[model samples]
Structure formats: structure tokens, C-alpha cells
Target: MNKPIGDLHCHPSFKPCNNPDISDIWTYKKNIHPKDLFKGILGVSPRRWMVNLFVKDLATYTQSNLDSCYEGDNRLLFLSIYPIERQFLRPDRPFASSTFVQRFILAQVFGIELKRHIDSRIIQILTGFSSTKVVDYLKSVYDSEYVDYFKTDFSLEYKYINQSHLSCSPNAEDNVATFQLVSNYEEYAALRNQNIIAGILTVEGAHALGEYNSKDLVGDKMIDDLSEENKEKLKASFIRNISALKDKEQFEFTPFFITFAHHFNNLLTGHAKSFGEAKNKSMPGFSNVFNQKNGLDLGISDFGKQLIKSHLLSRHNGQRILIDTKHMSLQARNDYAAIVKALRDEGDAMPIVISHTAINGISTRAKAAERLDTNQLDKKSYVSRWDINITDEDIREVFDSNGIIGVCMHDGRMPGGKFKDLLKSYKKRWPQKEFISKLHTQMFLTNVFHIVKVNLDHIRTLNAQIPIEENRIPEVQAWKTICLGSDNDGIVDPFDNFNTASTLKDFKTRVKNAIDMNFDPLWKRFKILDIKEENYRFFNENEITELKLGLTSEEIVDRIFSDNIETFLSTYFVRAYLEGTEN
Candidate 1:
């Protein structure tokens, strides 16, 4: 039996961008007569087979086509309910380009041709519009088309499970997997016992609340321009959206955490620097700049603080929705941490989480010394220097608050600079194409191994720097902070080896191999370091038993795969019971 794993962050509903139909061309080519007739046109041997077969396989797993989940036993998925940003469908450069060639590229290459079906006038109206307009457009499409599409593909034994169900246990006897909407740890545990996939809902951006836009002319106005009536209207809309999500009788898809900011800024918070659509030079007609100027370095505004106090931190049907700090600007992050700390000091505890992140290893002193005044700099000046990765201070804050940090799987985040170092070493050892082809299978696995090794080494180094009595944090406790958050189908370029959801099944074997290969060497180095230190303590009997007897590998893999995340959920949801339930 395959061991079950959990992905704390993923976009299972993002199929339009990762369309499976794009692979049909390759499938058709493979069926052509003689198969060798196109050997000259297409490369012969393995390259041809790779282009035809492997590409098709990649397509099938990239999209949330239902079969992708069953391909691997993904038991717990924190599924993101996203409203595709309107910038893609807008008919302008900063939003989108309506040129003939741009349309062709979007349709034939990128699989984002839905705007072509809509009226040109409507597309123009959507361009450079508020997030409210974009959300309304998305909701209409979701209700009319996308909902039914998902049901049809995921139906089990000819019976379609209603999407509105607060929780479901679809029959799994027909070689298809079951999906259950789980809100709390109790529900998650129950679903896992039945071997059903438990999906916890999350929202990618607060723009789904329907009253914000990154490029609004308000600029620094900060809600002061709104009349009393308009303020009430906006508040009503926000409440209505939250009520809809929490409605148990209807769509019970309330978010566990909402990322307040994304590629663009919204009314609720400022965003960190994110690459614009211009990153794809192939589509030069489309401008990449969105909210680059307005919300790049600004922290939480006064209106944002009010919204959090009045709505976000308040209970929704006896449960409070948490905030995700994935896309928050550095200033925003600091403000949020301070707010959470203040709340805790006042006897109200809220756990902090960064759903998908990388470690920057930036020291607290260095970060404090840098100037954060954005007004003096050009719009593009700080784009490259923006620190999106969590620093040591951020990690300590999360640890102290009993929070979890999910390590992202993208090449840009996970391995960061380590990937280049590993690639260099691999090329030096194996210079031939055939050898490199064989090595590609293990590349992602090796990268993950190195990431964990580097993280552990950093933790040990930090521990050595601090007095043991002052910093009582155990090395193993820090390891628990690392959880899997594969942002699959979120427009990320996946690691070469672990290209899709299905490849996760093989990740277990690779993790085991990594431990076996590095354990003895690490232990020997630790022993040598201990000899030079005063008041050195030997490895505890439990540690020796766990490492020498193979228990360490099992425990570490278990924690990273599912155990730690489950514990986090239990901790987070248990607060509702401890505090009085809101009526």
C-alpha cells in the first residue's frame, strides 16, 4: 500500500491554465504511421519518445483532471479556491492585449482562450477594473460552467457528488478516489480513517471579497474618500461574501486562511514584489506592470487594520479564519507579527503561518540596518531586492507563536541558490548527455535532500551561537517546522524529477535513501565538533536508539509528510473549543 501524504498548499481547481487538452497533439503524433517516418523531422530514439510520451504524461498530471489525484495517494489537500486575476483577460497591455497574434498565443499555446468567447466590449470593460468586477466575472463562470465540469470529471460510480456539500465521502470502490470537505481536525481525522481525501479550503487572495483593486485611484487616500453610505455598502459586501463561504446549508467552503495579497495589491493589504506578465517576453504586446507602483512597499493601511479588527479576527459561525503571510510585503509582515503578538499579550492567541516560503538566512541585524523607505527609490529599484523569503527572526516568531511554515516546492523558492551548486557538481561528474539524462530522474530528489541538510545545518549553527540555557529549542523541533506545500498548478515551474502530483509517491524512497547516505557522516562531524566544546552532552539514549535502529528516518519522513501538519491543524482548530463559541 502506498503511504498517504499531505500537501498544505496546492491549486487543484486551476485547470484552465494547465489544460490537459494541450497534450492531444503529441498523442496524435505518436499514432502516425510507421512511427519512424518522422525520425528526421523529429529527433530519433529516446528524444522522440520523450517528446511524444513523456509530454502527454506531463499534461495529464499537470491539470486537476481528477485522475491526477488518484495517480498518487494524496490524502490531505489544502485546496486553494482561487478567482483567476482579471489581468489575464483584460484587453490592454498592463492587463492583457487583444491583438491577433497575442490572442493566438494565448489560445494555442497558453490555453487561456476563454476571453475569446466573451464579447469584446465586456472584455474591454474588465480591463483595468476593480477586483470586485473581476471576482464577479469569475463567479459567474464558476457557477455556470466550471462547477459542472469538475463534477463530471470527478464523479464516482456514475453518481455525482454535490459540490455544495459541507462534507462528502464519495464511494471509492470504482478505482476512483473520494473527496471530503474537512474544516476542523476532527473531520480531517475521521475522513482519513475512512481513507478518503480530506480537502481543506483556502482562498488565494482577499480580492475575492469583491471591494478592492490594486490600481484604484485612491492611492494613499486609504478609504477616507468613501462616503458613509458607500462605506456601509462595502462592508455589507464583505460580510455577505464571508457569510456565503460559511453557509453550511449552501456552499460550505469557508477558508481556513486567506492570502490577503497576491500579484497585485488589494484593499486589504500591501503586497511584496511579484513578476509581471512582461516576464514572458514572447507576449511583448502585454505589459507586465500591474500594481507595481502603488502597493509595493507600503505596510498595512489604517483601513486594513480596521477590517482585521472588525471582520477578519472575528468569529464566523464559531470559527475564525486565519491569515496567510505568503505574499505580504516585508513591512506588512512585521506589522502583522506585531499585531498577533499584541493580541497574544492581551490573552488572545492566534497562530501565524506562511503557507509557502523559503528561508533567506538574513540576519536580524542586517535586515534592520537596511532602509525600507520606498518613496525615495524608483518603482523598479526594489523589485530585485525585495525579500520575500522568511528570515531568522521571522522563523523564531513563527516558532514562538506555535505556527507552521510550509516549504514551497518551486525551483525559485525551495533550493534557491543550492540548485545551481548541485547542477555544477553533477555536470562536472557526468559530462555526457546520456549520463545527464539518467541523472535527471534523481535531480529533484537530490535537491530536496540538500535543502533539508542545509536547513538542519543552519539550525545547528544557530544553536552553537546561542547559549544552550538561553535557547532551549531542540534541533528536532525545528525540523518539524518544515512541511510540504507543493504549489502545483499555481503557474509554477515544477522540479524536474518531481514534476507532478504522481511523482510524490516515489519521493518516499528518495527521502529514505538520502537519510541513509548522510546519517553516518553527519553524526561523525557532530561528534568531532562536540570534542572541542565545554559542557558537551552526548546524544541521548533515545536519540541513539532512534538513529541506530532506523526509527529516525521513519519519524522524520512521517513528520514531513503528514504528522506535523496534522498536529498544526489540531492545534489551530482546538482554539475554538477552548474559547467560548460565538453565537
Candidate 2:
């Protein structure tokens, strides 16, 4: 009777079965398999209904007909061997085999070697563009008819860029490199497929050292860091890049979730505070803290603050934006809390999302690996949020601020079976009626609604509890909206399940069965048999009505089935259904 009724976090790798007949789904678990990870391009039978179901990439998205969507696994399932850097994203240039000579020729097409002049004028590098050289590189990629699709994902993910990196300059070594290229030459090479109607261009990190005051370069006068002419030249270079994307090719340059370093602090800090922080940047090139020589004031806490300032520059552009917090720090998370308040103060409703991350502090250990799909025959090392390094107070800070956090699938300290956890955590934290009554006169200045509470933690400490007539924030208001925020392909083989990727059969069997079970008998002496589906309606319909998210219980059901995830995502990512339409 005490079992929870809803699931907030689950990966769609499996099917969620709500049918009330098969209560003990362990019998059906045998049907799910690990190889299902290759469900898309490999062996997954293409079911027609699978059309509207693929997880839309949170990055760049153009008008897409689900029919055209090659619903490949989100993870890098396989990579081509012949290509130097081939993660066969699409059946593009990398997928095609080329002779070493051809690869050499393609690489040698653009031989522009760059260097830094003693002039502190770094912005001039943008004007260093060449029509012939740029055009030649573009031809090398598309000239071969072997490509299935030439995909161009441009983001100067500099972590992979190092001394062997041809795009960067050797002369710029002595002085700090003003900027780093996100995408290497190959990605840009495949961009202008004049025949290919749509390509994608993205602005990576904001680490580029532009003159602080951009507007001052308007005239043919001298500016502060670079000459006014150099500033103008740099501005022109960026304009050319944008022009090429929008005008020359019908590429949709919808940029979202762009950041210099995903977890910037972990990268900036030379010393690792934790094993997780050690591998902050995927590419390990030149790195040092911003100190006096870097012409910046330094502080212990400023690293977190600086990351926010850099992101806010793009966020404040007045072009309705979705701020990304994937690599942001807890200090920065706290800072963003203030930023959101100030934004709401100004009446801005632009939504934001932390696209990828497990519930903080959940993966208790560094290497807690669980096979994505299991029939519950093996030991389950479930991770609790308290186990993750991040504190409970930090989670409260985020939720209290009205931010939505997604449950990631990859293994970590965070626990699975989110449907039950969602209700358990809410009931645990709710304030009691007596405490609310005593504080109501002072807290809300009125004896309005009573509070009902249960403590999940420190169970023995909470005793002699009595039921209250009403609940906190009025019976009309409780945290009603819990949405699925799954990371399908970040890690594990073929990805799956509630806390992981799951096949349709696995979802219905394991995740649904766990949620439907009556855990009230779990504490008893005899073996606690899981109740059959006919025994309970699963969710308490009355409490469901009392819950609030400005939507009815029927609507909540719709959300639990589908809508909420869309609404939470619509706040940040563009929906596949509306890719062609304007935001």
C-alpha cells in the first residue's frame, strides 16, 4: 500500500508496460537483451511506430521528418578504421576508405601556417582568411562520391587539439593562444555540400580573447587591445563564417548548449580534487589558471564565477536563449540560482536545462558498473543520491530554485527505480502539520493550511506522527510534475533500462514491476511476495488529484506517459516535431 505510483527518470531503451495483469515481471525479464543496444543501424528491427520516438539531440536540429531520421544509437556504437578520426557519425567521408595518398592530399590542400606577431593584436587572425585556400579545402571533402552523408559538427572541442593539431599555429606558442578552433579542418571541409540542403555550424567555447569593448571598433580609429582596423577585420571574419553557413548552404546554425569546457573548473584546476575532476577536458592541451600574467585578477572562487560570466555574455544577447549548465560548477550552480532570480525579476521566462548529468552524488563509487540490462538475478549495487560527493543541501538548492534535473542512465551512485524514489523523497521532506501550524502564524502570517510529513532519513528520530487536514503550500500545491531526463548513449554497451537503456520488453518487465510492487510488506518477517497487478491501481488517484503542477491529474498522466518531458525539454531543446518551424 505504501509503494509509490509514478516514475520521473527512465531511459526509453526499454518499453514501460502499464498493463495491470503481469505483476511479477521477473518472468518476462528473460526477453530483454544487451545486444539490443545496436537496435538502430545494426540489428534492431525497424518498427514503423519507432518513428516519433528517437531522443532528439539537444544541440543543433533542423527540420526533420521522423521518417528521414536515421535513429542511430546516441552513443558512438562503432568507428571506421581507415579514417584518422572516424566515429562514423553518418555515412560520410570518414566512413569511406581512402588511400593514404588521398588522405595526405586532402590534408595538404590548406597549407596556411599561422603565427603571432609581437602585436598584442590577436583579433586580426580572423581576417587572415583566404578565399582560394578555404575553397580548396571545401572541395577535397565533397569531391569524392563515396560519402553517404557529409555531416559537419563544428565545435572547437580543444581537448583533442594538441601539438600534432594542424589547425593551430606553432608561432602563437610563445604568447598565449588568443583563441582555439573547436572543429578541425575536416569538419569545416565537409560543411559546404552545396548539394546537401542542410549542414550545421556551432560556436564552441567563448575562450576567444576578444577586445573587452567590441563597439569601440566601429570607426577607422585605434582600439584598446588591437588596432581598430584589426578589430573590424576580426568582426568581418566571423561575419563571413556565418554568411557561408546561412547563405551559401541552407545550413541551420541553431546554436544551443555551447561551452568552452563542459566541466570548466575541473579542467582549469591543475590539481585534481577528485578522480572525476581529473578528466575534466577530453582533450588535454596547454592549460594554466588565470593569474596576474594572464592579465586577470585571481581568486580561489573566481574560477566558478568566470565560467558564468563567459556563458552569460552569450546568454544576455536578448535573442531568447537556453543556458546550458552541464559543465558548470556547484558554486556556479549557486550563482546561476541568483542569475535566474534576477532574470525573473526582470520578467524573463526564457527556460534553461542541465541537459546531461546523473542526480548529483548518486554514483557512490568511482567504478560502479552494472550491466545495462539484467533480470535481477545478480547483485544490484544501487546508488543513493547521498552517496555522490555533492551534498543534499546542494540538491535542495537546485530544486528549491525551480530548476528541473534529469536522471541520467549511466551507472553511478544515483539509484534507479526513480518512480518510487520521486514519491519517497517528496514525502520524506514534507513539513509536518504541527510544525507548519506553529510556524504558519509567523511564516505565512496566517493559520491557513495544515502539513502532512514523513521522514525517510533518520526514521527513528521521527515518531508519534499524526495526520494533518491539509498539506504544505496548500493541498492544491505539491510537486506534481516529474519528468524523464535520460542520457541514452553517454556510456555503457549499447545503452538501456530505467537507470540505463532498456528494450521495450525490459521496460514493461523490470521498471514497471518494481514501481507497481507494494513495498509495505517488505519490512515483515515472511517472504514479501510482490502483489499482482489487479491488487492495486498503482497510483492513489485522490493524492494524484491533490498534486499540483498547474495541470490536472489526467494531464499529469499524459506527462508521465509523454508530455512533461517535452515541456521540460521545450524549455531548452528544440522538439523534432517543430524543427522546421520558428521557436
- Give the whole-model CA lDDT for all candidates, comma-separated: 0.51, 0.25
| lDDT string, candidate 1, 364-397, tens digits | 4147226442212112221112256565666667
Compute the lDDT of residue 290 as modeled in candidate 1.
Answer: 32
User: Which candidate leads in lDDT?
Assistant: 1
How close is every model to the real structure, measured as TM-score?
0.66, 0.37
Name model 1 segments beyond 4 Å from true. 16-65, 91-176, 212-232, 276-291, 365-386, 414-475, 519-551, 575-583
Distance from true location, Cα of 371 in model 2, Å: 29
lDDT of 2 at 509: 34
Question: What residue pairs are clashing in model 1?
Answer: 92-96, 93-287
lDDT per residue for candidate 2 within 95-161, as digits (tens), equals 1233454333222221112111100011111111123322332333334322111122122211111
